[model samples]
Target: MHDQDRKLLQQMFEAAVHAAEPGAAMRPFLPARPAGRVVVVGAGKGAAQMAAALEELWAGPLEGVVVTRYGFGVATRGIRVLEAAHPVPDAAGVAASEALFAAVEGLGPDDLVIALITGGGSALLAAPVAGLGLADEVALNEVLLSSGAPIGAMNALRRILSRVKGGRLAQAAHPARVVSLIVSDVPGDDPAQVASGPTVPGAGGRAAALAAVEQFGIALPERLGSALEQGEEPPRPDDPGFARDEVHVIASGAKSLEAAGAVARAAGFTPVILSDAIEGEAREVAKVHAAIAREVVLRDRPFARPVAILSGGETTVTLRRTGGRGGRNSAFLLSLALEIEGLDGIAAMAADTDGVDGSEDNAGAFADGTSAARIRAAGVDPAAALARDDAWSAFAAVGDLYVTGPTGTNVNDFRVILIR
Candidate 1:
């Protein structure tokens, strides 16, 4: 029965991820083929797959360059796909973003720019503004990630310090009609926040970015601070460059969670979707989930036995120790393992939809009644692992680390807890 429950939970996760696949969700949102050339450009975990899907659907000549995370690249006939680092900027990403800028430059009104935007675009489109090196951008990103800043705040800083983000790419296309098809991973599915709104106008300016940085007590480089002071912001919503630009949300976390819920129903389980926009410190969020799971087990007031509690959203993790080896999802699972304390007939899994969590290779990890027992029998200390942020090793020792190589989509994190 435990093995069967694990299989069911894994199936639910796979269903959630498949619902956000670029090839499936991108087709209906495709723009009409323009009379002139079609130029495609984008950045994210799924950009290459999205480009491939567009090429498969369109019957016209399309030429463009798209940047994706290193392992997420897909082969396309016409559009060139480039691999780059994600969650942090790299030289390869910077070069690819510049190439994309050149690809859409000096386009006329007849030409159309199809931008495939997704969760990781902020890092994939790493064209830094003048006076900021890739190292500087990378350092800032490291601080932001470790500081536990929300995606919106981090993306705001990304836009201010970038040459291609915050509607600057749309501004570069000038007279061309820019159509941005987005896969949202952030809460609220704000078009302006997805991928730092490379083609969509941002809602705020340098002031907001500065406040976010200061709120987190992050020290900005001298040049970055100066740039923020200078207040050369991204294109406003009323900017003429976005006059003809259009943005469409092809898929989102909510849609993915709903798909997961459907899978649970088919498997003869009552699935309760808690929320699709959950966000907070990962361990704190795990405790909240633990509390709810306890309620279902102890009182069964909100939900009864044979139920699955599902949620989807991006959660932040503030690192207290250096040289830790886990992402937010793993951290959440680790904390959850400690919280539940080996409760019987309950199992849970937390994973990123993109098949990569933080800097690790595995998507995430899972915990069940026997998870702690397995770790203890192997002579590993789970509490110490959680304290040092070494969840990868802890879960790996128990063979509970969930790994799915490059799912070609990014809808942020998906979590489900099963009670029986």
Candidate 2:
């Protein structure tokens, strides 16, 4: 039964990923061929794949450059694909960002700029404002990741610090018509929040960015803080420079959750889609999920037996220490295992749709009623692992770490629990 449940969960995860594939999801959102040149530019885990898809879809002559994470690049003819670091900015990302800025320079009003923005672009397209350097940006990301702030708040801060974010990319191509196709990984499916809105404007100004820093209790370097206080605000939605710009969210976490629900239904389980915009600390969220599962199993109140509960959205992990091993998905699964220890007929899987959770190689991990026992028997303390933010090691000891290299798309986290 454990093996069968694992197989079913894996099938649903794959279905979710397939629904967000760059080629198919972007097909319906492609703009009409432009009268002048079509210059492509974008950054994300799926940027390279998006570029490859665009190259095959559009019939006109188009050429440009896109930056993606190191292993996420794909073969492309007209659009040059560049690789860079993710979740943190690096020198390579800086160079790629400069190239992206150069791609849209000197374009006429007749020219069209197709921007393929997706999740992870905040780190992939790393162009610091004048007062900040790449090191400053790297430090900013490290602090933000450990601060336990939500992605929206983190991105709001990033938009203020970056030269190429928050509609600055669109501003660089002023007078040219810019169309942005986004694969949203943020909650609420806001295109402006995805990748910190390289082509779309942010809702708030520098005040919002500072508010995020204060709200998250993030300690910024004195110089970085001053820069945030005094830096020029990025272009807003009302800016005339963006009058000709158009934005479309081509794919999102909601769509992925729906795909997973269909797979669950086909496998003879009544699917319940909880929500696609869930956020907060991963462990806390797991506790709530466990409580819901317990209610369904013991009383069958809200949902009867033989039901699959599915959800999507990016959950954050506030690192207790510096050298944590797993991403939010793994941490959530580990926490869930602890809550449902020895409970019968409950199995769950949590994973990132991009095929990489946090900085580790595994997308996530699997857990069942026996997970806690198996983990304990492997000579590792489950509680200790969770306390140290080392959920990957616990899952590894039980051979439950889910590893799929570079799925070429990023819709966000996919989580499902099955009870019978």
Candidate 3:
């Protein structure tokens, strides 16, 4: 009986992601370039697909390299695709990051560098700051990852210590006009933080990184501390490297939200897109969602019955709790269940369109009035699991887990709250 809603939910999520795909979204933003060799260099979950899009629309002989998360690569002819680890840097990521910077070096003014920047580029395009070895970067990255720091704060630190991140990649392509087509995954869609702004001069200064490190309580290496203290920080728009460059956000959370709303409407529910810029801790956001769901179920004040609250944006999951294993979406759904208890005829699904939440294998989880009973039947205490941040296991036991592997596109996250 509820399978219709579940299918609709899946369609909405898939529609949102599909709307943001480089294949559909990249063509209109493409820039016309004069006669020269077009080198497509990029890194992110969408890098390979974005590269393919550029290859298709791009006039002239196109050749380049783009790095994406492992298993996220799209088939492309002109541009070489390399797979690398994401959210955490791996050896392949390190090698590709180096090769990309080196590839664009010494290109003439006639040469064009099309940098396809997107979410997950930070780790996929890693380049250690000068005087810091890759090992040093890796160790510090492990600390930062587990610290539960926000992506912006984490990337701010990474920006300072990289020769390729921030505005450095654009710097490397000096005299050659660089155009960055970004698929935003960060809150606010700041091009600087999206994929660590490889071709864009970022907005973060050294002081900001220092503050992030201290805020997150991440143990830093000696070189990182020294670099943070001494480094002038990356360039911004004022820098000369940015003088002849441009950036186009081919996809964003807002666009994806609208796409989801359209899908819900097509499925016979009046979709209300709350906002695309929703932000907060994952579980806290879930509480807000719960409140809205309750209002619709009881009073239906802000919206009528059968309101489907839709939103998009990245949320953080601070793991002050120990041994947490679930992603932010899972945590959000788990928390939503707790707040609403078991409201009748209300259901919700939250998932990252990119097919990952935290380090978990599941996209996210599903929750409704029956969630409490399901948890009890599974012999898994919801409160205990929530404490451990293992909502992935909790949802799995209840057969409410969502797992869509590497959707080959990233448009931040999509969430649907349905009441009927």
Candidate 4:
């Protein structure tokens, strides 16, 4: 039963990821080819795949550059693919950002700019504003990741600090028709929040950015803080530069969750999509999911047996200490495992749709009622691992780590719990 449940979970994850593939999602959203040159600029885990799909679809001449995480790149003909670091800015990303700007520069109004934006662009397409360097952006990402602030708040702060983000890229391509096709990983599916709104205009400006800093107790660098206090705000929605721009969210977590649900139903389990926008700390969110699964298994209150409770969202992990080895999905499954230990007829999987969770190689992990016992038998203390934010180690000890190489897409977290 455990083996079957794990297989079903893997199938659901694959289905969810397949639904958000750039080849399929970008097809319906592709803009008409312009009489003038079409410039493609993009950044994210899926940017290379998006560019490749565009090359396959568009017959006209298109040339541009896109930046994706180092291992996520795919071969493309017209659009050049650049590799860069993710979740942190590197020198390569700075160069890629310059390349993106150059790609769209000197374009006439007749020319069209198709901006393929997705999650992870904030880090992969790094261009720090004046008075800040790549190192500063790297430090900022580290702080934000460990601060327990939600992705929206972190992006709000990121938008203010970046030169290529917050519609600045669109501003750079003034007079050209900019059509942004987005794969949203943020909770609300706001294009601005995804990749910090490189094409779409930013909202709330410095005030919102500052508020997030204060709320998260983030200690910004003295220079960065000063820049936030005095720097010119990003272009607003009313900015004439964006009048010709079009934004379309081609794929999102909600769509991925629905795809996963269909797979669960086909497998003979009634799938209950709890929510696609769930947020909070990873462990806390796991507690809630565990509670619901327990209720369904014990008394069948909310859902009866043979049910799959599915959810999709970006859950955060607040790094209490350094040296942890897993991402939020693994951490979440570990917490769920502890909560449901010894509870029969329940198993779950949590993974990032991009096939890499946090900085780890594994997409996520699997857990069952016997997970805790199995982990203990492997001579590891699950509670201690959880306390250290080392959930990856716990799962690895028992061979439960779900490692799927880059899936060429990013729709954030995909989690499913099975009760039978």
Query: Which window of 10 residues has the lowest lDDT sum in candidate 2?
Result: 315-324
RMSD of each: 1.3, 0.9, 1.8, 1.0
lDDT of 1 by residue, 172-285 (tens): 987999999999988889988888888988877888898998887767777777866774678889986677888999999999999999998898889899988888999899
Off by over 4 Å in 4: none
What are the per-residue Cα lDDT tens digits for candidate 2 across 1-420? Answer: 278898999999999999999889989888888789999999999999999989888888889999999989889998999999988889999999999999999999999999998899999888889978999999888888889899888878888889999889899987899999999999999998999899999898888988888888999988788889888887889998888889999989999888989998999899998899999999999999999999988999699979999988878888886566999999999999999998999999999999999999999989988898899999989989999999999999989999989988999999999998
User: Between which residue pairs do clashes occur in model 1?
Assistant: none
**What is the Å distance of residue 327 in model 1 from its true position?**
0.6
**C-alpha local distance difference test of each model:** 0.87, 0.91, 0.82, 0.90
lDDT of 4 by residue, 42-86 (tens): 999999999999898887788999999998999898789999998
In candidate 2, position 30 carries an lDDT of: 84
Measured by lDDT, the strongest candidate is: 2
| Regions more than 4 Å wrong, model 3 | 214-222, 321-323
Q: Total clashes, candidate 3?
A: 0
Superposed model 2: Cα runs more than 4 Å off: none
TM-score of each: 0.97, 0.99, 0.95, 0.98
TM-score: model 4 vs. ground truth: 0.98
